[model samples]
Target chain A: MFKELNHLDELSRRKFIQYSAKAMLGVGLASTSNNLWGSQIIGKPTAKSVIYIYLSGGMSHIDTFDPKPGWEQQGPVQTINTNVAGIRVSEYLPSLAKRMDKMAIIRSMTSTQGAHEQGTYFMHTSYEQRGTIKHPGLGAWLNTMSGKTNSTLPGNIRIGGSNNAPGGAGFFDSKYEPLHLGDPNNGLPYIKRHQSISEIEMQERLAIAQMMDLSFHQKYPSKKVQAYSDVYDEATRLMRSEDLQAFDLNKEPQSVRARYGDTKFGKGCLLARRLVEHGVRFVEVTHGGWDTHNDNHELVSNLSNPLDQSVSALLDDLHLRGLLEETLVVIGTEFGRSPKINVNSGRDHHPKVFSCVLAGGGIKGGQVYGASDESGHSVAESPVTVPDFNATIAYSLGLPTDKVVYSPSGRPFQVAHKGQALTGLF
Target chain B: MPLSTPQLRSFVFGLALLAGPLASPAEEMAMEEMQMDAMMDSMQMDAMHGMDETSIELFDAAKAVLNSYCYECHGATKQKGDYRLDQKSTIYSPGESEELPVVPGKPDESALFKRITLDIEHDDVMPPPKKARLKEAEIKAIKDWIAAGAIWTDEDVRSGLPTTYVEIGDEATNALIDKINETRAKAEYNAWGDNSVRVDLSVTDKDKLKEAIIGLKDFGTRLAWIDCSYLELSESFYKNISQYQNLERLHLDNSNVSNEDLKALSDLPKLNYLNLYSTKINDDGIAALAACKSLNKVFLGSTKVTKAGVEKLQAANPELTIIYK
Candidate 1:
């Protein structure tokens, strides 16, 4: 009876495989594969690499870079003058204020996408979301431009946790996709040697797996198979190389760790620095859970502590090591909170006006580029678009704004569409 | 005094020279055509000016009120939704979910202008959580722009604007190429020719040392090494000295070389070793050496090279074996 059941299972498996293959053939997998991998080919920036410090939840401009002291009653937080004369920042960021000479604060950042996902997508891709087309994220774009040199560590890496943004190698081949660390705040995952398996046993298992994979590819030569092979190669390379050292935060001394702070954001920032130090072209460290629609004051207060320490320490460390001139640090959020205090004593989603801070990478620091009204209600002067912000960063890193990448349909789209570099900032 | 007949005739001839030819039948017709063209040009200019005035009026009536009260934080300077009123496309497209800020030929679909017109208690009120709302007249002008197909007739119309394409001159192109070459040399990768110094490692390295060097060069290498003493060895000598399947190492010690050949020496990628003991090399040469990634070892004893240069070199290339006083 058991033999009969096994035979039935084998028959069903064979039938399923045949049906799937026929279905894939009908859908034209060959053409699809070409379009998926070969489309949206963007050139690499002149600057070899980038270090992205994404403040996952929207950081308040009033609380960070652009503080309105005269409107203390209207402003939610108290303001203090920074080292740069006439420039003021919230008291919460005293350390960052001292390093104002290293950054350019964009006070008049305006966006219509108030929600987190939309904002993150807009910021990452520079294209307004069209339901039909999914654009490649900046990291993916960079990966395409600067091809991966090391077979071990991925060209693009995201530390901390899974970012909410759909940060895939959109349009570009999935081979250039970002390799997320999952959660660097927690220790490295799935990297330990199995206790039960001996080295000989492990080697035998690997050989068997490789043999099976090779056989499978020989039979079914598809893009998926190619991707699988690429991943396998990367995994093997990682096992052999110094990539494991990237996850080993303990290698960093207690003093250095303390300087970066013990919080998750702190560790993530430290990890980003380490990854960049080791040759990863684009390393994004996202600290999330900043969506504070209700009880924003309480959330920002708690969140700002780690953010302040980590950001200040990262900037100082990069500057001291003379890496700041080359490395670009951007602190941003989805959108700013509503200036008007709600019934819950919180600020709702206000994308009308916000702030984003940019430092290093050849930017003229200690300068405020725009401003909001006295009541913090609207932009009083030069308003910066998402494209402009991305364009400025790209320009500072030596990526030309007019650099165009083509879609599958031969449509030309710039890396940062419709954005001129804020030449004042540089 | 009265002019003579001959002098008068001479004056007439000079006048004729000044007014070279009289209007022929064809010339008269052409003159009439020119006059018509000038009139048309003036009319078009007037129409354009009128459109500009209308657009400016509409903008002042709409943006001035909204931006003054609502857009201080939300305007072009501080775009909150990745949307800005500074650009017409952003204003029209708005975000992924929302309807257009101003629907052409329909005011009812224009959520942005309507929001401002709503009462303070209403959920769809303009400046919902901000300082103030737009006045009735301000809302009316926005309604008018929407009624007139929400046409952006200003000189700053994003569409159809002539993109000023500046053709790069030969000198500029050459300078750019040199900059890229210098960057690559410092980066330590075998110079892949594009517009820069044409150093084709593919034909030169049959053993694939160039490929190995390219493989090793990544974002990490930029952070790790920072000097060019490793690049002091000549490319001609280093090309023949092959050990690794991927890289060619060269050792040049106590070599007779001036600061002038520094550029040529630092340009080579296969260079791995250099010993400039008791040479005339100075800080200038050290500066040039900073771009050479292949240089892993250097000997700078009893040279004109400064202690500062040596210190910087060591800082940039921690793995480099430096022998100095």
Candidate 2:
């Protein structure tokens, strides 16, 4: 029984599991509930939540945020003013350009890891891919630090990403793991039980399973075992949760849906907006196929349309409901493509210099931070490293990046691993 | 693609064996030792190239110390040594001393940076012998600030914030205001620049929401935005909420707020965004809100608000964006 639930004996049908203990492990195995509580928040946070938009493949900076016009490296892509004076982006982002007053573009993002897997892992966890130990991603750290504001819902969610994606609850408590959602359009798969299986029978099966694995789990007590057991408990609670409507895209009106458009990416954006609106701490929506190694211009232009439309609508909708100030909308990628146009008229992987964007969350708007050279080949001034960029994100959430948490094996690790935040961005 | 008998085993059967789930603890410890050594070497390499502090961070710390301690003497009011540290230009300008106050990239040459670190026994040490001495941390902050280039940051965005409705109210009114402000949502004033007040209650509890909201009627004048979207009972709960003259953005989505409840909001001059999604409010509600000329965006999703009702609102306020579905 929760210490706070004495007054509320009967659970309401609408708002179930508002007490966090019921939302996590304490509900299932009630015995081993001591260490599974969410950490009390420490610092005064700037952003209450974050929407991490991860572009899985390397997005081309020269063709997007950093348009090097008149320089041949820019290729055939035209540039337009971004409403803010002296700032211009690719022609494809006309809608975003008009609302540039709400965004800050970082043009000199550089990274050392060039391959897709390594770079993606590095960006997510802010550390090199080491064989010895896995590191927790930003989501895991966030839940571990402040807990979830919406205690009934999952602490964090990742939409449109691989099931075995990098930056999961690595080496962290399994309760802090993100609920991997494959598509915003689809409901939580297998959330409902079989019609024939009675509730009592399901509870019996779960108890028997817990008893059978009790000894083995106690003997080793590894992160994997904790994660496995906790996942089952999470799903059982989630199945009965009424807030499950947060996942159902159909709840949004058709007009609202049409404004974001028909692409899965657009739906994913709308889902991100809804989840954050419900007080979920962190949400990451991954949009892939950005690795434009061939037919760069056409492929990027096609991709840019959905990205522009959905993000613009998302920004507008958030402002409409007055959520833009506290919700941090971030556009991040593993790395950017090469500046040089290849024989296939496509750009290859280039980790030397790229671009990312930040908006809302107390960030200064209508400004560009750092810059690449005229040809967009290398960082010319104020080069921001991958860890530094992520550190700024942590800073917005009031996360103490200097404080280190020890892994299971007692290895020290910080959120961004000693990366200094760009304080001026605030 | 048929599976063989050997390949047809249940996943539970395979997992029950527990083949040391991803490496045993002993083996992990053994492997981790070698990795730690390699990581130590990398840490040294990083130390050679990594920055201790960025220029902006140094300046932020240094200026904070200056504003806290030195500002009393060498600030807007009084400049004891004919040195004003308020403006960036005045900070760099040479005062009585022949040495420059700040040398940008070279902090060792800057007189301001040097004075704070000078020996207390010396006559020129900052804060003087009679005043409180600077802490080691404060000195370090000053050093780092100068090392990163003493560039000044502009912090003028916090001006023109909303002023309080009552400057000096009665004890009962002030007490009522305090009670209303208990746990009210607030903007991140420190991050935004100043202690400017901006109220937002987008996500609040439904426990005593009725009484608490009725309480807001006393001091609700400060609120421009309030969201009652997901609450269970949002019907005539708008006791005195409609009379809140400064209510700019209001969300009663997925509720039972009626036409009469919205009718009182028709005269608000600054109401910009209103969301009445999934509510029982119909054409009468839209008609009641038609006089809101300042209304810019409105969401009527899943409501009985029809095209004719929307036309009535738009006809009165042409700039109104009616998202009716």
fnat, candidate 2? 0.02
Give the alpha carbon lDDT tens digit for every residue of A114-216 in model 2. 9999999999998888886788899888777545555357878999979777888877666777888887889578677789889988788777767766765
Best by lDDT: 2
Question: Worst 10-residue stretch by lDDT in candidate 2 chain A?
Answer: A25-34
Cα lDDT of model 1 by residue, A23-83, tens digit = 5322111133212222122222223456777776676656566666666434467777788
Error of 2 at B192 (Å): 12
Q: For model 1, how does the per-residue alpha-carbon lDDT over B1-325 read when each residue is reduced to its tens digit?
A: 1113343233223323322363243234333433432333233222232233455566556655655675665576786555466545466786644657767678888877667677788875767645655667777877886776665543322221223322222354434323433322222222222212112121112233444344323222122222222133345433433322233332233344556555555655656655565467787777666777787766666578788888887787777766664
Instruction: Show pairs that collide, candidate 2.
Output: B58-B145
Candidate 1 regions exceeding 4 Å error are: A1-46, A72-76, A198-200, A213-222, A407-412, B1-325
The per-model DockQ list reads: 0.01, 0.03
